[model samples]
Target: MALLDAQAIHPITLPDGTVYRDTVYLKNVIDHPRMEIGNFSYYTHSGRREDTALILAPYLGHACRERLVIGKFVQIARGSYFITSSANHPMAGFTTYPFRIFKPETFGYKDLPIKDTIVDHDVWIGQNAAIMPGVHIGSGAIVAAASVVTRDVPPYAVVGGNPASIIRMRYSSDVIDELLGLAWWDWPLDRIEANLPALSSGDMTALRRA
Candidate 1:
């Protein structure tokens, strides 16, 4: 079955029969309810390596309520980090100083608004990319290596560089609309296997007819 299907849960078993472990081999991440990693999606991290421990793919979660939701068929390269929205201080028009922190009660919902980071299906995030809080990456978007994503990414768009800018759209608007409508990622395992011909190649004609 596609990894992020309705039936999917944490600790999904991979093609290699390796189970998805949180932070370490299926340890801390499995326990954390806020984290939602899709099926067949994986992250590669670079840090101190220990064979027995659960590898740390840094979530960079904030103190307030923040969430990281990644979709199916997503591929995250090593060093990719998510900077959640909860960590930001009030800086709109006002000074970027933390004057509110001095008063313990000032850290209320009004001061730090809750923003969740969401990455949609079939996205690819390259190495050392930093996704800012409240950034909603559309389905089939490609984040270029070393990119700092500060805003929302459109579906089928390719973005790169610091403060990530749009490189290009992978397909024409019509094609993208069709693809999004199809939502082939939500197909069942049997149907996916059966439609391999249309899925693998850019058989838009066949896909459209299907």
Candidate 2:
């Protein structure tokens, strides 16, 4: 319910020098009151969010929700697509009838089942990616551009390609596990700011120990 000032956050300036302003527009999905975007998130015109979502769209379509959870400090890029709903069709009989024509109470429209997706903190989703419903993206993961994510992405791993194959680990599995346990994104802002230099350097060791 509280509206934070967009100006207080830094703006994203495109290579063409165009600027985007609305924080709400940056996400393809959202919950409420959990957003913590950094300085340059941007969303193209084709993104949307559900509810109570936190987003950091440094490029485009930062956060997209589908009745799921996105943890703090996640970064998303431009041209990414997050799909939550599949178009409903009648199961009782074969009909191309419009949704309004069928009573929601009778056909189960009133109880359209939706699964919540979760994206943990400090994740990075690359450009032009697509995330399907009912999938969880773990903390500190990296999803490469144009990847089609059909399954859960493990924490601190790198995934890419049409079906999103694991390209490599950004760090050793042990290091990744340790960082997840550290959970630095949960720290207070002042504490995080004090360690900004190390965090920005991608020093997993320093971050984990900090």
Candidate 3:
């Protein structure tokens, strides 16, 4: 009923026995109140929660402190994580030590410039991928598994590898434009259910009619 809080890893099964979504935990690690997540999104800890034996195990929103807006129909695979601007510690100083962190006098969140991380509609961030802060992922983009995204991703781009780059665009510019125009994700639940067949079949004619 709301964005994820401290209680993460909630899975709801539909009448067809399909796993609706495993997430709702966006509020847990993010310090910003403006951060928002949408319906049917899976964003949370997986089996790694109990793996206390792993050394320095990773977690979602480990470096978060500011805005992170996720759009509807976004699929965030298990173990996927976000690296916020807070992780960008000052490494230019004489010593790469964060003295301010230990010293309360200068200790504050403003030490680093915070930038909002936005994931637009229909995005699929693969397992263990790291989305750095300030990254504006365009709609329909796909981030490959374990890839570390360091820049903005274009809409419908299929990107992978460390410091993620554009592997390919999912569709031609025209088709992409049409799909964006359709924006089925924004439609009401009843409309979506009514048009599910057309949507699943990628029927542009049916979509347009809807």
RMSD of each: 5.2, 7.1, 5.6
List model 2 lDDT by residue over 1-210, tens digit each: 212233333244457876453333333333243233332233433223332132222211233223435666667676665665333334565864646547756533434445555677777888889887667888889999899998888988899998998888888888777777777777766677778777889886677667
* Deviation of model 3 at 127, angstroms: 0.8
Question: On residues 1-210, what C-alpha lDDT tens digit does candidate 3 reach at each position?
Answer: 332222444544568977555443343333334457766555645444233111112222434466668887788777777765666677666876777778778765465677877899889989889888789999999999999999999998999998899999988999899989888888876778788889778787888999
**Poorly placed runs, candidate 2 (over 4 Å):** 1-66, 85-113
Q: Give a tens-digit lDDT track for model 1, residues 1-210.
A: 442343333335679987655222222224344566665565665443342112222433334466677787787776777777655767775677877667888744455677778999989889889888899999999999999999999999999987899999999999999999999878776676677799889899988776
Off by over 4 Å in 3: 1-34, 47-65, 109-111
- Model 1: how far is 168 from its true place, Å? 0.8
Candidate 3: deviation at residue 179, Å?
1.5
TM-score of each: 0.73, 0.65, 0.77
Best-fitting candidate, measured by lDDT?
1
Q: In each prediction, how many residue pairs overlap at the backbone (N, C-alpha, C within less than 3 A)?
A: 7, 19, 2
What local distance difference test score does each model get?
Answer: 0.71, 0.60, 0.70
Error of 3 at 70 (Å): 0.7
Error of 2 at 175 (Å): 0.8
Which lDDT value does model 2 have at 31?
A: 28
